[model samples]
Target: MSHVHRDRKKLLTRVRRIGGQVAALERALQGEADCSDVLVQIAAAKGAMQALMIEVLKGHLNEHVVAGKTEAVRAREAEAIMQLLGRYAR
Candidate 1:
């Protein structure tokens, strides 16, 4: 968990910036900014969100999921990972 603290912080910051980008997108739309510019902002927000998701998934796989020591625990980790993959895939 401590190992991921830095990554978590980075992800949090990314998310916060994405939120700002969303607000900017709204303003751009109302201000009649160029369509391309508004779409670029939207795409940036989506990329930030996807990056955050990847960070979380990597943390899980590298920590709790891989650190499992027992068959049952490993199985549960696999299940958790499967569920996460499903969500992310969609």
Candidate 2:
């Protein structure tokens, strides 16, 4: 099975938490919360998103790159990861 499938439950839990953070951010904006409070919410949501991305990236590297059966397959996975990082970095 793929790493994503193996880690589905854990990933889903993180996603749900991120969703809650986003919802809180929305509510803060709607409620005209203090600027500092809104900023804190924004930071929390951003950190959660980054954490999720890192987890998935790590899994992809481990399963598809490090443990790949062939050098060609590993190279392909590395290129895909590089492409993803390029987009993400911008």
Error of 1 at 21 (Å): 1.5
What digit string (tens of lDDT, one per residue) describes model 1 on residues 1-90?
454675767877878988998999999999979999999989988888888788777877767667777778878988988987898788
Cα lDDT tens digits for candidate 2, 58-80: 99999999999999999999999
What are the TM-scores, per candidate, against the unseen true structure? 0.79, 0.96
Worst 10 residues of 2 by lDDT: 23-32
Which candidate leads in TM-score?
2
Error of 1 at 31 (Å): 1.8
Candidate 1 segments exceeding 4 Å error = 1-8
Q: How high is the CA lDDT of each candidate model? A: 0.82, 0.97
Which residue pairs overlap in candidate 2's backbone? Answer: none
